[model samples]
Target chain A: MKFNNRNVHLGMNVRLGNNVRIGDNTTIYDNVAIGDNTIIANDCVIGEPSWEYYRHGENYTQPETVIGASALIRSHTILYAGSSFGENFTTGHRVTIRENCRFGRDCQVGTLTNIQGDVTFGDYCKMHSNVLIAEFSTIGNHVFIYPFTVFTNDTHPPSNHYKGPTIGDYSVITVHCIILPAVKIGTHCLVGANSVVNKDLPDFSFAVGSPAKIMRDVRELGGGGLYPWVYNFERGMPWQGIGFDVWSQQQ
Target chain B: MKFNNRNVHLGMNVRLGNNVRIGDNTTIYDNVAIGDNTIIANDCVIGEPSWEYYRHGENYTQPETVIGASALIRSHTILYAGSSFGENFTTGHRVTIRENCRFGRDCQVGTLTNIQGDVTFGDYCKMHSNVLIAEFSTIGNHVFIYPFTVFTNDTHPPSNHYKGPTIGDYSVITVHCIILPAVKIGTHCLVGANSVVNKDLPDFSFAVGSPAKIMRDVRELGGGGLYPWVYNFERGMPWQGIGFDVWSQQQ
Candidate 1:
């Protein structure tokens, strides 16, 4: 393992596997475990205290962050305390994964993406650049989210109760889509660009526009044929193919 | 030039003009040049390799990133190889500009904005937070793009053909507007918030709604009078406006 500077702080009981690289000024707190071949870039803050607090100035307990094998966390990314990631977790620059976030294997998060506290993602979930997944969101496997998509959790201002949306498996959300609080998007659904998803979506539905309505089914337009790249991730070869495949897939 | 640590790598033949201040953990690669009085914040990776490659495993040649005078690059921003900028390039946090991107003088890119490879922007172009400019996009001078705007480059999936939209000078794209590929947005046009731009817009037109159509001429509502802040950028003071100019532009 290579440490670019001695100023890098590794707290008590922190375990790092073989060939792990921690860059300059990176601070990993206590009880954090990073698996093998994981590269944590410069100035990243891992296992920071959570932002959950009570109205009376009390704070919630902070938990440990566990990163699985072959994870590549880029520079300036912040992983709040209590976050856990599966194997082959990769993120672009300035990504923020908040406290109590759980991710499955081979999930790729793009640059400037923020997953707020209590978010859960299944395997091979890819999010494009500048995406915001609010707290308590649950995403199933093979879900693809395009750029500037926002999953909002709050309905009323200053409300104590906040519930995020639940996305089913193989759902594709295009660019600049906004998913309202507590919305349930079913599997194999496609939400077009600039859509505002307010209600629930059925399986294999194609929805578009603000307050998005179902336009057609994926099976009607030849299912799985429109998105050949989704098959690559399903087959565990997430990084294969040309510019359309690699660059377009939030990697 | 102020280096936070001596371990910061300043590559060979890198010309840094006077009063250039680079923050901690910043790596400026070889052949990169920064003009006088530029401030690059922490954890920025300047002049990294481009994300372009051929089908036969051959990668595109990396190019130098040139920053003009009096620029301010905030934290966690990554400028890929083959990018060039004119004077006074001010950007918010975590902006990523890919390879072969070109920018003119006094351009302000807001936080979490990503300009994909081969994009071009003219002088006094101001893009708000979380904007995505896809590959081959061309933007003219004095263009103001609001938050969550996306310029798409691809129409059909799995096809090799890619083309981006061309936004003309003095145009204002309001928040959450999506410009589809190959569309031409004319000069002095105004696209309303959350509009989906699927076709071409004429000069001085005001467009709104999905599959954006021209509603009226911008000159009908008094040209340049509606946006007083555009004149502020034309002058030297980008941030010298009052509350109406600063707060209303975002909120």
Candidate 2:
């Protein structure tokens, strides 16, 4: 949608609408389209690393990345290869969204968060600072993650190996929680602070403690957990609320 | 000796002398001391865990840490239990001196550097930001370590395990170098940036490149390597015609 004075290589598949603004030290490579009212902030590295067919000892691979329109990617946020986001997305400083990841519309990511490749998120998701989302994770809509949470990618980890994790929509992962590799978290769930998740969580549940266990069910306890009461004292409003009416349903 | 309004406990065999100043939020437990003109800054935790002689069980183990005269321990610099420093020391923010270590006088440690336990440094040592000194290492006098250099503690490392590395002093370790553990570096050598030290280097030599090897000798190259060049540029002074006799060692 926008172009810097620096080098840019665009493909024929690229498209853009009006009033899109791009800042300094940003790179948006080929095969990307941006919608209207999108603002890509300063020092952002967007899109995939493109090259001709590679010959690595007679083996090779090919991949691509995409971005939806009206996505407000903030400063120093890196959207690596094979990653995609829906419209009206906003992310804070130093956020890394790795390759093959997808985000729903109006998603918000806080500062210094690291999101690994091949993860998918539903609409209106929110994540806080210093959070790590490992590869192949799935997150549903209306999810909230607090600061300093880490998600792993390898269940059986030999050093430097990566697999992935999974998280469903409408989930609230609290501050300082660590989700171990290959763990799957269900939808409409609440994970307390400083908890370590090592296994699967049931849907519509509330989980807590060091190694997380289900405290109660969300539908039985209430539609939403006690998060609204506890987070009322947090300083400064990050955002008000997201309109979920126009969100597209995933097949 | 120094004592402020913070919580402090002095154990047996602790020592102290004249002209010491301690700041707020400092906790000084057993087996430590203050030398003359030594000013410890705010929010410091000094001294080691004390030995407790129990009615039963094996003998308790605790080591002592000492601070020398005219030493300037700055704010948030933590001297962990079982560490000591000689006279005329200055340290920057959040510098960590781990247990069982010793340092000679006139050593300047830069911000966020970690000096592990059981390490020793000679006099007139200068270290820059984010440098890591491994355990059981020894450094000689007049040594200069640049920013972001890492000295390892184990040659054969198992993920979170710690071993030790050794170094001879009067050496200049450049920025962003990685010194593998258990390797010994000799005295009066110059190590370049981004180099990885794998084996022992001889004294009075220059080493560079990954898996560093000896390139030149500092004695033959003369003029104290590149320090004078950087110092002249930093001080806005000309390189030539400056008499060394007029330059006082004390600032």
Candidate 3:
């Protein structure tokens, strides 16, 4: 059930699994592998050349892009070479996933989000619209990011060394927040809207405001609970229908 | 005269004015009206079903999307049903205008900007790339918003009532500013970059910082001046015939 529309270009050694739908004018370049039940929407440029330029106009040879099963990639997305995604990866329109990135299972990225090169995301991470995760960032499992958030990687532009932020498991970053370069947010932390995180935040903290200060512990906050999706995955991936009852109960 | 491609899907009762160009794989749904000299780029999804779903499985039946004359909707834009745009409307690539949104004449929305449902914009509003205007917001005439600005519509999530911010005429909101819900920014105000706007700002004020405070009047600022495009519009939409003079002068 592979439907390759007109003007779709598949490069050398590209492997697409069963029930894969490739839309018109979409280009999946060399060494890419897309798993079963994946839909790559129209005008997407998957496995494009990496944006890694070395000294004196030299470019790094990008590795292949590997996409797992049940992925829904919306229109106009540009997934550069050397990126990998696990099962159940969903993205809204015009997402840009750059080179050398790894996304774990059940990751949902919203519209216009740009994950720069060399980023890593653990399972069940959700990023809302218009977010930017800079290069070399590491996000743990069950992380939720709201709209218009930015994670900086370089303190100064054109620096030789760039170190992005690190977020532990179950961290929540609210709308319009900016995490500066090399910042670390520990597990189960909640960063409030319009905040700027410049330092390290401890586990189970509720941080708010510009230059985000730890307000209180997560236990002190009402309506704070573990992500329902994680609970479903614990039972066995509910998206795959193994734990539908557990997922529905949470909903 | 409508020029439909092999893969273009024009719905029933859709009206296209003279000299309209729609690119390949574009879908214009039922009751959409496009005026003369409009260009809709490739892979666009025009008049798509709105994301206005209510509890108990009820959904809002969106009205027709209407576009005025001399518009340029770039590639991969998703203009939902019930949105109305005035003359000379220009949008960058992959823009998303939700249902029931009203954009005035000469409005320019940049790439990846999302205008949520029920938003209203006055004439000549220019929003830069990656902006998010939440639902129910009102922007007055000659408003210029820089990149990555977020307008919050609700103080708390899942609240029954939501109220967005009000931006007055000739105001300029710089990059990475977040305007809180129900806040009012007065006419001709200038909000600086990376600021969090939590309170009402007076007319002609220049505000900055977290919980943005008014530093001085905009007139006192060195670079304070009307947007160059306004000068061209005053000269009777010179962009149509002035041979890029108005456009290049600004650059």
Query: Quick one: best DockQ, which candidate?
Result: 1
User: lDDT of model 2 at residue A156?
Assistant: 64
**TM-score versus the correct structure, for each prediction:** 0.81, 0.45, 0.75
- Considering every candidate listed, which one attains the maximal TM-score? 1
Candidate 3 chain B has its poorest 10 consecutive residues by lDDT at: B50-59
Q: lDDT by residue for model 3 over A106-199, one digit each (tens)? A: 9989888999999999988888788899999999987888898899988888787799999998788889888999999998788878888999
Predictions ranked by TM-score, top down?
A: 1, 3, 2
Residue-level lDDT tens digits of model 2 in B55-75: 111354556778889988886
In candidate 3, residue A94 scores what lDDT?
Answer: 80
Better of 2 and 3 by DockQ: 3
Better of 1 and 3 by lDDT: 3
**Steric clash pairs (candidate 3):** none
lDDT of 1 by residue, B82-201 (tens): 899899999898788888899999999998788888999998899998788989999998789998888988664323468999999878999988999899998878899889999999
What docking grade applies to model 3?
A: incorrect
Query: What are the interface RMSDs of all the models?
Result: 4.9, 20.0, 7.3
Query: Which ranges of candidate 3 are over 4 A from the true structure?
Result: A1-4, A12-18, A51-64, A155-157, A208-210, A218-251, B1-13, B23-31, B41-45, B48-63, B74-78, B154-163, B186-190, B200-206, B214-251
Global lDDT for candidate 1?
A: 0.80
